[model samples]
Target: MAGLLDIAPLTEKVRVGGATVEVSGVSAGGIVAMIARFPEFRMLMTGKDVDVASLVSMGGDAVAAIIAAGVGFPGDEAQEAAAARLPLEAQADILAAIIKVTLPNGIGPFLEKLTALLAVKGGAEALAKVRATKSH
Candidate 1:
């Protein structure tokens, strides 16, 4: 008989550059690790207005880490490096796809809020403050 632990993880394919990459929902533990390692990630999961600049400040390393984690290749430097090579827009798309699988309600609402936030004042500076505040 199959058990709960025996079930295969749910996966989705997303395009990055010119390739379709398969990504899975990150595990609870993986999410926790991300939050711990990059506090800015907590803001993203909040489903509130996220500071894009703050996320960007975390830089390519953080982006790569998130991609690697979602792709079920956590700690694989080659995977991370590959992800780092993708354009920022492609990275965002991939992140959204990962969130689709990770969150029960999907990333639709979150992206909407983010879009609205981007239109507001403070932009990158606000995000910088957010990242700074979370670091301490």
Candidate 2:
């Protein structure tokens, strides 16, 4: 019954601050907890443009919290503190790794296509024209 629906959590091994750590894909519960603790996280789920500046302003504490939650250690102050101590590059890598596991389809292809499209001359204008045509 329930066991039939139980799938193992997706996990990845990542190097963080000279240590190899296993990071699990964020679960439904983890998403809920993140939304509860950090309302800004909801923007990502909703496909809204997240304010990067605002998130960065939240500083290391927020980054630590995100890492802890993604690592399946939500509400663990000790774990969060440890994550905060890691170098910024390591933190970014861990976050990227977590996102990779969490998103089944992965965003790399989409981003690459988007970047290519945006690189084209008048791409924004063409997109706007298409949108305008659709609205008419």
Query: Best-fitting candidate, measured by lDDT?
Result: 1
> Please, what are the lDDT tens digits per residue for candidate 2 over residues 65-93?
87898788987999999989987778877
The true-versus-predicted C-alpha distance at residue 108 of model 1, in Å, is 12
Best by TM-score: 2
TM-score of each: 0.63, 0.65
Candidate 2 clash figure, as a count: 0
Segments in model 2 whose C-alpha atoms lie over 4 Å from true places: 1-6, 49-58, 106-136
Per-residue error for 78 in candidate 2, Å, reads 0.3
Query: Given candidate 1, what's the lDDT at residue 6?
Result: 100
The C-alpha lDDT values of all candidates are: 0.73, 0.69
How does model 1 score by TM-score?
0.63
Determine which window of 10 residues in candidate 1 has minimal summed lDDT: 46-55
